[model samples]
Target: MKQSQPRYIMVGGFLGAGKTTAILKLAEHLKRQGRAVGLITNDQGTGLVDTAMARASDFPVEEISGGCFCCRFNSLVDATRKLTATTRPDVLIAEPVGSCTDLMATVTLPMKQLYGENYRIAPLSVLVDPIRAMRVLGLGGGRQFAPKVTYIYRKQLEEANLLVVNKCELLDATQTAKLVAALKQNFPKADVFAVSARTGDGLAAWFDRILTGELSATDIMDVDYITYGVGEAMLGWLNATARLSGSPVDGNELLLRIGCALRDRLAKADAEIAHLKMTLTATGDGLDIAVANLVRTDAVPELSFRLAEPFTEGELTVNLRAQAEPALLERIVREVAGECGAALGSLASFKPGQPNPTHRVDAGGVEHRPVLP
Candidate 1:
């Protein structure tokens, strides 16, 4: 029998938690299972790397920018309606902004109460980078986010129905075991799973759980709006679009150079990188693209996707998130893009403002209307 409603799954986590890779993997899995999938990508600005990556895969995608899903509830609904009208996908996977939390009360709850008949809201799964999780949880030592930033990270974990530890390949048996144990102990209600989105290891079990899982009734997590707003403002966001020209240049190599340049410059400024990713697509051939990601200040950028042949010209999209000033990020990107032979076309940089959700509902089934400006 055909289902009456589509499954709506939101995969969320902190910046560089491998949400895009995991979502793509899951979409591929669903396609093989004869399910049409639609993806929704969210960001603070346009020129999003995630949006480019998703579109490259040939999936129907809708992008929601300017704010997160919670704050832009109406936009979220509009994206779904548009997708439904066009593709009518059997499953819709939405990736929320990494720094925004309080989804249980602000997003899922509202959708479940308002549009329950139109869609089946699955359990919220929040992914986490083991290295970052360890540092934040005091399990290991490394560069860490400020206290306010850590507060947002903790709140995300608190609200997740499924706590997923992605990129497990980076951890050893003992380390992975300890981290899983710690998460289970910390969030007793959430079921924990560790898998690598890059390597197909330990994914089937997780995929099965999420596909068959249902959201349960639980107390909403308490979030301090003041701290959430302050934490977001501390992380500078920059999105730039550039035209890559000059002789036939290797897109992959150019991406690495720009990523390294930004990493070095930001490190000198004492800026902790949350996530820096870029995509280079052939000027006319959208399918031919190169992508790179750098999740930490100390880590080297890795090419998640590579171009087949060198291209003389292409379109470059760069998304950078770090604990630095927006001006510094813009200057660094502008310099690096020029140095890498990419003529900067458009760029936007700013710290995200406070979040004011359009609709918020608590566990008691009461709605909290947002304060209009």
Candidate 2:
């Protein structure tokens, strides 16, 4: 008989929750163990930051754009097959859209119930950004989401087989303990861990658990189609590309400045940032230069992407989100590039385009159509 195919492991999280970073850490760990790895990335639009990040590792990266893995299930399976054929990886790592949830019903359950023979579906792992979690759970003084956004976020946690508290490096022991306790209370069945993908802290434990088959099917939530529809309808996404050349500044610094500038501009324009993320990769090193995230513009930004060393030459890829018009996003990119160039004493070029949405739903039936410029 053919050797058992590699297990399918998925890392899911809300927007700006460090899924890409965590996935990268896990990929490295698995590779060190002499296991071949394949990666699949899903997003609502093309030119995704996660795809770029994954490809930077020289892994076989397949992207399913224009929708989540759930709605674009065929694309996901096809991408998996392509990765399997191309890399023959011992393990597959798939990162779904951060804004998405209900993986059990959409991806995991289907994989287990239908494609059980070809692949062993590992437990679905969900990552949460501590700051975002605090804000969403109303523990922080951040703006409260109108019922719809709140519903979507809660549903994301409900279906997780493993709930990971990412970016725990920012928290103290007491804070970490509180978050862990909260997660336990909320998701009693799921294994909860505090990890910092950037620093490689607590990752070994997580890696061990994931590799040791510690997860099982249990107590997955029943998703409400209507609420899910409303949750999706209320969000807006933007993906854009920019060209930059500056005095050899750290790539991480460039990303941080650019992300902050755009985020501030959007905030001034009265936009609520659901997630604003940007990735800069050096062409020479073939590695990520910088990555930054802002779950809300009013909140302090988080650095999700970083480099151990700096790069002098590379282009920047940005994915920004706000409860505002697409044109505004384009404008913000243009303005931020100019600002970044001025600071670096170099010319920055920006090319903005409409984000091609892969998934669109109006569960509230409010007919709140997004206006594009």
Candidate 3:
């Protein structure tokens, strides 16, 4: 028996934009209303902190690893097929690679033109951290990404059907107004919204739109592939899974220690941090997550979540993105694992190469092969 085509709600943004947190909020909202939800997480590598975080929330997750959706379109569809075979969720919430843009041409178009019979593509939403918005919009001063990297980030905003200013709590009414005005002035076409996914400040309206609003064709932003590749190469990407055992250490504390150590290492390298997030899930009843982010070179690392207790054994997933050399990032990861008493497992650390879209078809019948860098 064939079930009805489910809805695909994609949430996109640049690094440190809080896309995962917003997706979790939307999932929880949908679940509360008796709607079955399935999640899809994409990354350049495996052992994704986002994947682990979704599973920690107890949602069924399908991870499209090794590449972004544009490069792994077939795998994304296959994951959806597998989820349909099992969970058959009414809504499929997906988070694409933060560094990716042009989804209207790549991901959603393929989903609609080919799988129109199986999936309803929702409006394209792009999230932005308030602090990031200020820096990107030139409304405030802070250490920022290089010119090429900022180009990719700007393209992400330029292509948004809905531009969501996440982490609104950090901004007061006046500051929020200023940022909103700046975003509107820049991307006048996109409908701007402000919300705090953590505090539930203004998510209902966004959720309602995603649930019932219509989705139409979007403008494909002009992107220079060479520049995009350069921007991506400027950032070192690291993903790893480690085993933690012996004398139960506070999962939160251990993660904090590891993150602090890594932050110090990156700082010494004179690297500008983008985002460093980790999640630890013990074999017992729950999971703990610790995320430290340094948006710029001269910024302090801020922990988003801290563990409450200790755990004996579990799996830990760590993901780091920064403007630095991949070799240095890889070395710091190894040293951090050793110094923090973690038994390392499968690990991947490298700079993201140019995203070569394997499929750019509007209608169905296109087979996409994963392009590994």
Candidate 4:
């Protein structure tokens, strides 16, 4: 990697792990250092809530939809190129698909081998939501995925060079210290950092590390693609775009109705929600957008973000990931969206489909060529 190359950093985690918010925090830090910044977002399909939310924040973002980074390696490269060519950002922050793992083998190593002349890739930083982390570590009782689905989550942490315990605001000093100790004990190779992406409590140290740290070359975690496929197939995903019209109060009410309805349905089925994210962007006001996120069944729906003021009509993007069938997920979202749309006097809809990763390259650093038949 040459000094002329721009620094590349990827922040990954399981669903609802606050990757986007952390990316925004990192981008702000880089900008303060007088470094130009660009962001890349990934998803299993188009009309992504993450992409829209990032754009709403006024960052230079390019989205790789239809698959995760591992499954869409070439598309990931293309998005990087587009950002570099247009924004010429001094630092590039990428947020991989939450459910995707094996970054050391699939993403960073390939970029270092092929594009090292133009990009200095940083260490893999995997973020974790504190509540989910506690449940996984057995410190608390909450909804969690089955063993097969959980295989992907643990592999994410296993391969991480830096395991970030995000959303520090959820726990106190003791709980935070305990979780950090557990992570270090569980994964000795990785450095653990606790930061609140919502409040910027510990972002300073985490941001400084990204700006100066070196990416480890050796790969970790032996991923089983067959099991990976099964685990991913168990998750049902839905991304929908809808036209919403109502007062600021009505808009918020409408959004709440859709969210609550889905929550009740998903919880009733005993299906743990991987993540359900929504964003409402008004025309002509990119900076003012409403965002909401729900990661678990026990959690209440709250506005992770709020606009200066809501608009009468705006574009709404809803993203859903859960342990239910695609048809059931689709039905729940559509029915709720339809009810809200009718009451609020607007159009609401979405398209849900089975997610299939188009490409799964397993070669670590040695293989320069993409795994293609």
lDDT per residue (tens digit) for residues 65-127 in model 3: 888998788999999998888898999999999988767678887788778788888888999
TM-score of each: 0.97, 0.83, 0.91, 0.91
Ranking by TM-score: 1, 3, 4, 2
Residue 199, model 3, lDDT: 95
In Å, residue 322's CA in model 1 sits off its true spot by 0.6
lDDT, ranked from best to worst? 1, 3, 4, 2
Q: Residues 1-373, candidate 1, lDDT per residue (tens digit)? A: 3466888899999999999999999999998988989999999898899988899998999999989999898999999889888988998999999999988888898888888899998999999999999998789998998999999999999998999999999999999999999999888888999999999888998888778888787678767888888898999999989987878877788778888888999998999999999898887898888999999898999999999889788788889999989999998888887687778888999999998887789766787654433
TM-score of 4: 0.91
Give the true-structure RMSD of model 1.
1.5
Best candidate, lDDT: 1
Q: Which candidate has the highest TM-score of all? A: 1
lDDT of 2 by residue, 1-373 (tens): 2237678899998877878778888898888877889999987788887887787777789998877787788788899899888888888889988767767666776676667788877888889988778777666676655677678788888777788999899999998888888888877878898999988998888777776673364544555656666556556677766666656777776677677777778778887787877777666765645667777777766676587665666677777756666666666776777776622222222221232222322222222222333
Better of 1 and 2 by TM-score: 1
- Going through the candidates in the order shown, the clash numbers are 0, 1, 1, 0
- Scored by Cα lDDT, where does model 3 land? 0.82
